[model samples]
Target chain A: MRVNGAEVEAAVDPRTSLLDLLRETLGLSGTKKGCDQGACGACTVLADGERILSCLALAVQYAGREITTVEGLAGPDGPHPLQRAFIDHDGFQCGYCTPGHLCSAVGMAAEAARGVPSYVTADLTADRVVLDRDEIRERMSGNLCRCGAHNGIVAAIAATYAAGPGERA
Target chain B: MNPFGYARAADAADAVRLGSAPRAAYLGGGTNLVDLMRRNVVAPATLVDVTGLSSAIEERPDGGLLIGAAARNTAVAEHRAVRARYPLLARAILAGGSAQIRNMATVAGNILQRTRCPYFYDVAGSRCNRRHPGQGCDAIDGHNRDHAILGGSPACVATHPSDMCVALAAADAVVHLRGARGARVLPLTELHRLPGDHPEIETELEAGELITAVELPPLPPGAASGYRKVRDRAGYAFALVSVAAVLRVERGVITAVRLALGGVAPKPWRARTAEQALLGAPADPATFRAAARTELAAAVPLRHNAFKIELAERTVTAVLADLAGEAR
Candidate 1:
């Protein structure tokens, strides 16, 4: 599979998960394994730009896909825009769940840009992007912050993305 | 997880051919199966990756929708056709798992996923008949506030946990299946079986029979639909009681309606009795309440889950009333 923009190859056990392949074999530990079961969002990673839980994903099943982990968020210039906003907004305390939250928020921005509707969205007929506080909280419901830094995290996400029209200032 | 061989099927025929081997299983996105495998609930010898198969969500010529089995929950929920015509389906999918899980879970996996009964997952401590037939069910008498209140046998009271299937059932969808015996179709409402003496036999599909697609039939004229779920939290939790309804009313009277429930029965329950009760009744809260009562008249609740009886009634009533209001 392609890891972070580079093509890499490795032989793996049939039961090896994508998370294990990245952490154990490929030496990318930025993607933390919290629950290993799908309950926790700590294993969130992007495959072909869509967020998925690497712990439940078998490595062999995603042989030809492009995977982006927390490490891929930065460019040659510096940290991604969302990363800078996260630091400015104090998005973490102990900093354990920040990686998953950041990755999930990145993917969520793409989803919002493409007009994915959450349960809280008032209209479901057409493509609509309203990245308000409620929408952000609903979209980021999967990624939990145990350190109770959600207000700042939501603020970081809101400040990073342009809140669509009709959003509160 | 246990070691297993994996192969990606080229198509339906290839999947059936590769899956004909004993102990071979079809792997969708593996949100639930992988978790179960980690818990040692299921171990298959070979896994046929059918994600390469049909994942198309095509518009049928008859104004219905044909969703391929491999279509991700996110795709189907976000499809323009589903949002415009089948809002119940789109809403149900959104009301389901978190964004990551919905992105990974497939249409077929959602239908075939197991129950969330605590006893069934407690492989190391609790005895569950669904896990091991004849082992006796601990939920029947133990702490089972979430167990099924209807259509459960003494052997098992586990409730099927798919929100999408309930909407499909309400829409009168049909499931397409393929196996060594060729292809066949069954109503979505009849696909899952009620837990009888054999709670382990959750589905009617024969060994190696793979679900290829689900076809949602066209709704009646002027029918308006919606899905409502009541859970423990505002988001990201299994439903304690959910109602999906498609209703048509004319001149303040019910003309046509279809109802299905989740988190209450062993399968996605087709609320036919409730529909019959509301067929000609006035479109009002009283009519909805009467129909809900008729539907739950046969429900037998467990000790800790008696509250489900009232919750299901109120939810069904509220959902139908909302849909009826939309129609009028």
Candidate 2:
């Protein structure tokens, strides 16, 4: 499987979760394991550019798939746009959940771009999704911010993609 | 979590062959199974990965839908046909776990998910009949606000946790299964068994049976359908009481009504009695309330869950009233 932009290989026990393989084996500690169970989205990562919980994900199930973590959400220029937006919007206090928030936000942005209808998305037949504050909160509900920095997080996300072009279904 | 052997099956045939391991279980997106594994609720020695099978969502020429069991929950909810024709299904699927779990969970896996009852998950502290047969059920006299009020037994009262199953029950969805006995189909309503003396045997599937697909019936004209879930939190929380319904009214009369409930029963409680009471009745709140009360007459609630009986009636009446208004 590819991690970030590089091809990576590791021999892992079948019990190894993608979170364990990343934090314990591959040395990518940016993805925090807040809850080994699936309740907390602190271990969120992008599999094939879609958000998924790494703690519940079997490392073997994701073999040969591309995984992107917070560590890889940058260009040669520096921190990714969302990362910078998080800073500008003060999207963190203790910063424990920021990494998961970053990756989840990126995946959520793409989902909105794809016009994926959320539970709160009123019009199921609508061609475009409006990424308003309601949309951001509902889409990112999986990732919990314990520090109560969700207001800032929502601000950052809104500033980034709420007004951006959404996808037509 | 115990160490387990893993093998991916290319198709349903291969899946059955691989599932022959004595303690083997089919693995989809590990949203629920993994958590259960970590909690020691189930410790399978072998896991047969079945995601390699068909994940197609086919909009049949008959205006119905056939969803492959391996299709992701997100995929099923976001499909154009599902959103347009079967909005109840789409809404129910979306009402479930957050986007990440939906992206990881499969159609069949959602049907087979275990209850999220705290006592059931507390392997070390609580005695669950499903977890350990003959060991008493603590939920009967324990903090059982989250337990079942309908179709419960002295042995168990755990509610089925999938919001999507409630919609399928109301929609008359058919589940296609392949097993050692060849192939068969079961109505989505009949797929799950009540926790009557054998909560361990949750589903009607024989050993090594694989759910291949789920077939949805076409919606009737003049139908207004939706799923309404009441939960503790606004998001990411399991339903406290959910109502999935489809209503077709003509001249202020209830021509057709399908209703099912969640978070109140061992299985998706299809309110067939309520539908029978509702048919040909006025599409007014008075008739709706009466029908809901009639359906819930058999509700036997636990100590902490007695409120659910009244809540269920109110939810049903409200949902029907909302749909009746929409159908107008």
Candidate 3:
């Protein structure tokens, strides 16, 4: 299996989640596990560039699949734009849920840009979903930040809206 | 988790053969099964992985979707044929656990996911008829808010928590099952059995049988579909009162209608009476309201779940209204 573009093989329990495999087995703790039950956004990661709850993913299912953790969010630079924006907007107080929030925000913004309709999207079949406060709140409803930094997180996401696909405006 | 031997099945036949043993359990994505194993709800001696099954999403010549049982919820929802034909199913799958869970959770697994009753999860010497047959039902008189209002026996009232099953029932889908004895197709609505004499026997699935596929019939022309669910929270929560509606209206009259209610029944509650009422009536608010009222007429709510009947009625009416607008 590929973790951050590197192939690694280690003995994993059949019940081990991808989050545990990355953090415990592979020694990559960048992916935080706030709620192991998939309630919080702390265990969010990208599988083949699509955002998913890592805490709910089984490690055995990701054979030869690409997994991008928070450690891979940087590109030899100091940080990704979402990460930088989180800093600029003071997106974290305790910073426990920041990684999952950042990953989910990136995926949500990409989905919105690609015209994926969500629950709050007025038209279910609409091509484009406008990202207002309500849309942000509804689309990111699966990811919760207990630190009360949602306002800042929303600001950071709004800032990256126009930049499009991995770019921060 | 207890250590268990693992074997990946080559196909459906192999899966059934391996699962024939009482100690072996078929494993799909391991989303729910793994969680249950960690919680010690289920402890199988052997795990048979079925991820190697074919991923083909075949469209029947009669205009139906032949979804492989192993098909991930995400793939089944995003398939072009499914999206264009059965939008209700796609919508229901999208409104489940999470993106990751959907990616791993198979259609068969979703249908077979265990009950979410709080007492069922409390395996620490708790009494649950579904868990331990004949032990007794502790939920009948205690914390019955999420309990079923329909098709519930005195033994158990645990609600089946699959959003897709509700839509499947409304869409008149068929479940293809393969076992050591051979293959058979059961109507999706009849797949789940009422908790009658035996609450332990939840579904009609025979021993060693594996769900191979779910077959969805073609939608009628001008058929509009909708899924509406009210839960404790907005996203990622089980349905409190969910309604799946597929209605066809012609000249302001409901030509045909299929209604199924979730979270209000032990199985998917097919609103046959309500559908019959709307068959030749106007697809307006008044008719939909009357039909919704007729469906909840037989609801026997518990002390704490009296609100579910009214909530389900409103949900049914609201979905009917939304679907009627789509038909026009």
Error of 2 at A116 (Å): 0.6
Which runs in model 2 stand beyond 4 Å of their true positions? A165-169
Worst 10 residues of 3 chain B by lDDT: B95-104
Give lDDT per model, in order.
0.91, 0.92, 0.82
What is the clash tally of candidate 1? 0
Tell me how far the alpha carbon of residue A152 in candidate 1 is from the true structure, in angstroms, after superposition. 1.4
Q: So what's the TM-score on candidate 1?
A: 0.98
Query: i-RMS, every candidate?
Result: 0.8, 0.6, 2.5
True contacts kept of each: 0.74, 0.78, 0.25
lDDT per residue (tens digit) for residues B1-328 in model 2? 9989999998899999888769999999999999999889999999999998999998888888999999999999989999998889999999999899999999999999999888888988989998898898999999999989899999999999999999999999999999977989999999999988899999999989999999998988879999999999999999889999999999999998999999999999999999999999999999999999999999998999999988999999999999999998
The complex in candidate 1 yields a DockQ of: 0.80
Give candidate 1's whole-model lDDT: 0.91
> Please, what are the lDDT tens digits per residue for candidate 3 over residues B93-178?
87777665676688889988888988887889578988888989889888999989887888888899988899999999999999
What are the per-residue Cα lDDT tens digits for candidate 2 across A12-97? 99999999999999999999999889887999999998999999999999999999999999888888888888999999999988
Looking at model 3 chain A, which ten-residue stretch has the lowest summed lDDT? A160-169
lDDT of 3 at A127: 59
